[model samples]
Every structure is written in structure tokens, then in C-alpha cells.
Target: MPIDIETFDESSSDELNTLTNAEMVVRFLATNDDKAYTPSEIAERIDIKKNSIGTVLSRLEDRNLVRHKGDYWAIGERETVRDAYRTHRIMEALDERYGEEDLEEWREHAAEGE
Candidate 1:
């Protein structure tokens, strides 16, 4: 079957819009790491304020969702590697309809069953 891009944008929810900038940042990190992203690569992906990514990374570290592997980030011991893989799947699914910005916005909506 052909991929239909509209599926990701329609049937959304309020919770998605509720995702704070920090949460959005975590989701991005979670997503890229699943795709085997490097810190430099993730740095290239986000256009947030200076040190914001660092703060988010620090927070993820505190939450045990990610760890610093030398200069790169790795999945946490307590975190589910499959979760990263799942986000990658969702990224592939929605990429046709949404750009990076839209995907970030769509997260909570999709999380809420978009």
C-alpha cells in the first residue's frame, strides 16, 4: 500500500500541545539516539537557545533515560531501547507529512492517539 501522509496530522489531541520545551527536547534526543545519532548530529538538528540541549541532556541523565558515553549519549540502563526504536518508527511514519518542527508539535498529539 502507498503511504498516506495525512494520517499523522489529523485526529490529534490537546495533550500533544502540552508538551513543554524540555519534553520536546527529550523526545528529540530519544528519537535520534534510536536512529544511532551522535551528539554532533543532534546538535545540528535542534535550533534552540544556547545550552538548552545541554540542560535537556542533563535532565535526561538525571531521569536515567540517557547516559554520557564519552562525548556521545547512550541509552540508560533503566530505559527501554525499544522505545527509541519505536520513536524512530513513528518518525519514519510521520516524516512524509510533517517537517521536524511539526513532528515535535505532533508528539503529544500522537502520544494522545493522533
Candidate 2:
């Protein structure tokens, strides 16, 4: 189920505020594969400056959240796995707020050959 608009009203801004530079990096990694991504790629993908991505990457690397592999930036040994299912729940909630009408359940409810 997609997130409903009513749910958006109940959401806390603090949750959004909790996203930091490293978290941004983590989210990007989570969005992509388990391979090593260069700082340039991150900057391009996230629309952040290359220098800023570099700094964030350095911090994440130091904290063991990411590690360098054979020309790839892979998740570090200490990196904690994120729950993709939970993210789906969050995405559903947001979609509801945005008034998205293409939700699967809603499509199933549509009339035939109207």
C-alpha cells in the first residue's frame, strides 16, 4: 500500500533531519550495488559537489561503513545492513501523501472497459 496523505501530517521532521552526510552516502550505497563507487560517481548521482562527496566518503571509510575493493567501493565489514522492506513501507507512506493514484491495489479496483 502506498503511503497516505494523512500519514504525512503525523510524520516528524526530526526523522528527515536525522539524515546526515554519511547517511546520505549510506542511502546512495543502499540504492546501488554492493560494489565500490567512486566519489565522482556519488557526486554525480547525488548532485553534491565532488569535494563534498570526497569528504563524506573519507568519513564513511574511516568509520568502517565502506571499504575499497578491486577498483570498487564495497560495503565495509562493519556496515550495518538496511531493511529494504521497511524502506518500502516508508515509500508507500510518502506516495500516499503525494496523492499518487497508480497504487497496485487501486488499479485492481478499477472498472473494466469503462
Candidate 3:
């Protein structure tokens, strides 16, 4: 099988470079922290694909960046979310200053047990 490479126009590329699904979901829930909403509601509010919302929510929950109960989700603890967001910004700044870290290179050097 062969893969095709499609060129993206400026407008489309700009959209593609925007926030990741996790970032968008976190920001949306943070902004409306007082309320918990179903995945469908969050998807509609944030303009993300509904089908992908569950995966995003699950990952955030694993990081303790978001909470889930019944069929609804909400931002996690104030301090935890704040700390996570701060760390994220710091990493972005470091990546911009120094080219992004190569995961493959790190993996190659990682200790056997790790």
C-alpha cells in the first residue's frame, strides 16, 4: 500500500497548527469549571469531533487534569490543573527555544528497566 501526500493551503495549515484536542478540551472545561457536561455537550461547545472526545477525556482523567462521573466530565482540582497547565507552557517555551526533543533518541538511550 502507498500513502498519498496532500498539500495544505495556508488557511487549512493554520487550522491544522492550532491547539490539540486535549488542550481544547482542558481549556473549555476550565473556562466552565462550575459545570460538568456530557462528552457530546463538550464536543459541541468546543467544536471538536464528538467521537474523539471520549479518548481525550480519558487521557486527561489519567493525568488528573480532568474528572469524570456518570456520563459527565469536568476540570480536575484547581491546583492540579494549574500545575499541569504551567508545566505545559514551560515545555512549549523550551521547545520553541531549542528544537523539540527527539523521542526516538531518548528511547534509544533509556535504561533497560525503563
Clashing pairs in 1: 16-108, 16-109
lDDT of 3 by residue, 2-104 (tens): 1113313322444346768997788778878899999999998878899999999999999999998899899999999999978977897798799899998
| Candidate 2 vs candidate 3, lDDT winner | 3
Model 2, range 15-106, lDDT digits (tens) per residue? 44555566656666755655567778766766667778767777777866676755456555532434533564578688768865676767
Global lDDT scores for all candidate models = 0.56, 0.61, 0.82
Could you estimate the TM-score for every candidate?
0.44, 0.49, 0.79
lDDT of 1 by residue, 14-96 (tens): 42444544555555555455644455555456545545667777776786677786667765653454575467558856874
Cα shift from native, residue 67, model 1 (Å): 1.5
lDDT of 3 at 43: 90
> Compared to the true structure, candidate 1 yields what TM-score?
0.44
Best by TM-score: 3
**Scored by Cα lDDT, where does model 1 land?**
0.56
